[model samples]
Target: MKIVQISDTHLTAAGGPTEEGFRLLVRHLDEDVRPDLVVHSGDIQVLDPDDTADRVRSRELLDLISTPLLVVPGNHDVGMPGLNAWAGITVTDARVAAHVAVFGPDHWRHETDEAVLIGIDSELLGSGLQREADQWRWIEDTVADLPVRKPVLLFLHKPLWSATDEPVDHQVDVGPVARDRLLGLLERIDLRSVGCGHLHRYRQVRRDRAIEVWAPATAFLAAGEDSLPDGRQELGYVEYTVEGGEVTAQFRLVPGMPQITTDDVPSIAQAIEAMTALR
Candidate 1:
C-alpha cells in the first residue's frame, strides 16, 4: 500500500502563501502520487488553540484530500500540557473533545493488509492525567492482541527520542518519564517505524530499533539547528510504501513553495505577551 504522510501544515484562518503551497501540494498528490491513503501527523492549525476559525479552515483544507485519510492531535491541536495555558489557552477536556467533534478521534488504530497503524497524541504522553493512563492501557491492550507477523507503525506529533545520547527536551520530543514507559511497551510489539512532526524539518533517526521519520512543515521554513545538513530548509511531506512486508519512505518537496524567516518558534512568553498587548 502507498501511504502519503503530511504534517505540521500550520494553516491559519487568513489564507496566504502557506495555504497556496498546500493547495499546490494537494494538486500534486491528486495528479502524481495518487496514493492509497494520506495521514496527517499533526499541527493542523496555527498557534491559538481556541481559534475556531483556524480549525474551520484546517478542516476545509483536509477535506480537499480525495484519498483515505487519518489524523492525530499535535501540541497545537489539543494544547500542550504544562505549557498549554502558558500561552493563555489551556488544553481542557473540552478543547480535545472539540477536535473529535470536527475531525475524528484524537487517536485510533487501523489495520491495513500489510501493517497495523496506531496513532496517539504526543502532547498527552507525559501529562499524567486519567486520559494519559487510559491511552497507555489501551495501547498495551492493542499491542497484546495484534498479529505478531505484521509490523506496527506508530504515528504521533513528537519524536519518541531525538537522539539516544541527548537529554530529553519536552519542547521537542516526548519527556523522559513517558518515553521510558512507552519504549518499554513498544518493545514487546513488532514495531517497524514511527512517523512524527513538530520539528518542521525532515529527518530520519533510528531509536529502540524502530525507524523514526520526521515530516517537514508545509507552511514555512524551519530556522534552527534541526534544519537539513546542507543548510537548505526544505518544505515537503513524506510518502511511505508498504509492500511484501517491507516499508520504504520518500520525502517529496513541493515546487515553488514560499518560505519566510523567523527567529524561532514562538515561546510561551511570546504568545502570552502578544495576547496581553492585544488586550
Candidate 2:
C-alpha cells in the first residue's frame, strides 16, 4: 500500500489559482504513482470567517483528488479572529464534516495493503471536553483486535509534542493531556508507524516504546533566513511504500524543485528581514 500526505497549505481567496505547487504534486501522482490515499493534515482554511468564497474554493481542490483521504482541522481552520466571538460562530465539527464528506469518516481503520490506519482529530481535544466521549469509544472499537495480518498506523493533524522552541505555531500546545490519553490506548495495539503534520517543517521523534513518527510538511518551504534549510526549514512529504513487513519512507521535495538548503533558506529569511527593515 502506498499513500501520499499533504499539509498546511495556507491558501486564500485572492491567489485562487489551483495552488500551483499543490497541483503539480498531485499531477505527478496522477500520472505516475497514483497513490491509494492522500491524507491532508489540516490548516485548509486561511483563518478568516469572512473568507467563505475562498473556503469554497479550497474545497474545489479537494474534489480534484481521485484517492480517498482522512482530513482533520487545524487551529487556523477554527477561525482565529476574535477569541471570544469565535465560540459563537465557528463549528469545528461542521468544518470536519465537510472534509469527511469529501474524504472518509471522522476516524476509522482504513484497511490498506500495508497497514490499518487509526485517525484522530486533536482540534477538539480541549480541557473538560467529555462531550466527545462517544467519539472516543468509537476509536477504541475501531482499533480493537485486528486481523493480525496488518500493522497499525496512526494519523493526526497536530503531533503529541514539540521537539523545538516554537510554541504557538508548532506543537500541539494545549493538547498534551488529551493526546496522552489517546496514545495510552494505542499502546496495547500492534502498532508500527505514526504519521503527523502541522509543524510546517519536518522533525521526527521516537517514544522509545511502541511507536515512531514520520513528520513531513507538504507545503510552505518558506525558510527565509530564520530557519536555515540545512539546519532550519525543509518542506516536503513522506512517501510510504509498504509491502509485507517492510515499510520504506522517503522525505523527497516536490519533483524538480529546490528546497531551502542552508544558504538559500537563510538568505530567503534575510530577504524577508530586509523587506521589513526591522533591524
Candidate 3:
C-alpha cells in the first residue's frame, strides 16, 4: 500500500503563506502523488488551541484532500503536557475534547490486509491526565489483541527521542518516563516503523529494529533561533510504500512551493507574539 504522511500544516483562519503552501501541497497530492491513504501528523492549527475558527479553517483546508485521511493531535492543536508549555497552554481535557470535536479521535487504529497502522496522541504522554492512562490501556490492549507477528506501523506528533544524544527535552520530544513506557510496550510487537512530525524537518533514524521517519512540515521552514538541530528543513511530505511487512519512505515536495520562514509571515509572527504575551 502507498501511504502519504503530511505534518505540521499550521493552517490559520487568516489566509497567509502557510495556507498557500498547504494549497500547493493539496494540488501536488491530487495531481501527482495519489496514495491509498493520507495521514496528518499534526499541528493542524497556527498556534491557538482555544480558537474554534482556526480549527474549523484547518478542517476545511484538510478536506481538500480527496484521499482517506487520519490525524493525530500535536502540541499546537491541544497544547503540551508540562509546566513550560508554550503560551502556558498546557494539554487539558477541554482542549483535547475541542480537538476531537473537529478531528475525529485523537488516537486510532487502521487495519489493512497486510499491516496495522496505529496513531496516538503524543501530547498526552506525561500529561498525568485520566485520558493519558486510558490511552495507555488502549495501546496495550490493542497491541495484545493483534494477530501474531502482524507488522505494526506507528504514527504520532512528536518524535520518541531527540535526534542527538542529549537528554530528552519535553519541548521537542517525548519525555523519558513516557518514552520508556511506550518503548517497553512496543517491544512485544513487530514494529516496522514509527512515523512522526513536529520538528518541521525531514529526517530518518534507525533505532533497534524500527525505522523512525520524520516528515517535513507542509507549512514554513524552521529558521533563526527556532531552527532544529538536524534534518533537512524543507517543505514537503513523506511517502511510504509498504508490502510484505516491509516499508520504504521517500520525501516528496511540490514544485513552486516557497521555502519561507515563520518571520516572513505576519500572521505567524503575530501568533507567536500572542503566545508569548500569554506567559
Candidate 4:
C-alpha cells in the first residue's frame, strides 16, 4: 500500500498562497504521485476553529484529491487542550463536533490486507473531556484487537516527543501523562511508524521498533523565531510504501509549488501575532 501524509495546511476560505500550495499538491497527487491513500495530519484551517466557512472550504479543497483521504484534527482545527492553548482557544466539545461535521470522525481506523492505519485526535489528548476518555477507550480497544503481525501505522497532529531528550513541551509534543498512557496502549501491536504534523517541519527518527515521521506543512515554512529544532523546515509531505509488513518513507515536494514563509502571508502573520500577544 502507498500512503501520502500531508500536514499543517492552514488553509482559509479567503484563498491565498497556502490554498494555491494545496492545489499544487492535488495536481501532483493526480498527475505524478498516485498513492493509494492520503492522510492529512492536521491544521487544515488557517486559524480559527469557529469559522464555519474555513472548515467548509478546507473540506471542499481536500476533496480535490483523487486518492482516499483521512484527516486528523490539529490544534488549529479543534483548538489545543490545557491552559496554554494557542490564543486561549482551548479544545471544546463544540469545536470537535464542528470539525467532525466537516471532516468525518476525529479518529478513525483503516485496515488493508497488509497493514492497519489508525488516526487519532491529538487535540483531545489532555483535554480531560468525556470525548477524550471515549477516544482513549476506543483506541485501546482498536489496537488491542488488531492482528499482532499486522504492521500498524499511527497518525496524529502532534508528535509523541520532541526533537531533543528534554522535558515534554505540551506546545510541541504530546503531554507527558497522555503520552505515557498512549504508549502503553500501543505496546501490543507491531507498530511500524508514527506520523505527525504541527511542527511545520519534516523529520524522521527511530524510536524503539517504530519510526516517527514529522511531515512538513504544505502551507508555509517555519523559520527564524518560529522554527523548531532538528527538522528540515521545508514545504512538502511524506510518502510511505508498505509491503510485507515493512514501511519505507520518503519526503516529497511538488514541483510547481512555491516555498513560502509565514511572513510572506499577512493573514498568517496576523494570526501568529494574535496568538503570541495573548501570552
Q: How many clashing residue pairs appear in each of the predictions shown?
A: 0, 6, 0, 0
Candidate 1 weakest ten by summed lDDT: 260-269
Q: Please say which candidate is ahead in TM-score: 2 or 3.
A: 3
Q: On a 0 to 1 TM-score scale, where does candidate 2 land against the true structure?
A: 0.74
Candidate 1 scores a C-alpha RMSD against the true structure in Å of: 3.6
Rate residue 50 of model 2 by lDDT. 40
Query: What would the TM-scores of all predictions be?
Result: 0.88, 0.74, 0.95, 0.96
Tell me model 1's lDDT, rounded to 2 decimals.
0.77
Candidate 4 CA-lDDT value? 0.90
Residue-level lDDT tens digits of model 2 in 121-151:
6555651234256567777777666655467
Error of 2 at 158 (Å): 0.6
Which segments of model 3 are wrong by more than 4 Å?
A: 164-170, 224-228
Q: Across residues 195-268, which tens digit of lDDT does each residue of candidate 3 receive?
A: 99988899888877788998999888875333356687888999998887887788988788998888889778
Tens-digit lDDT track of model 4 for 4-86: 99999998999999999999999999999899999999999998999999999999999999999999999999999998887
- Cα lDDT of model 1 by residue, 1-279, tens digit: 999889988777777666777898898889888999888999898767778998989999999989989999887788776653334444567778788788798888999889889998877776667777788889889888888779788899887774334433336777678778888888777888899988787877666556789888887775465322332357899998888887777788876666643333344235546864643
Deviation of model 4 at 158, angstroms: 0.2
In angstroms, the error of model 4 at 3 is 0.3
Ranking by TM-score: 4, 3, 1, 2
Ten contiguous residues minimizing lDDT sum, candidate 2? 79-88
Better of 1 and 3 by TM-score: 3
Best by lDDT: 4
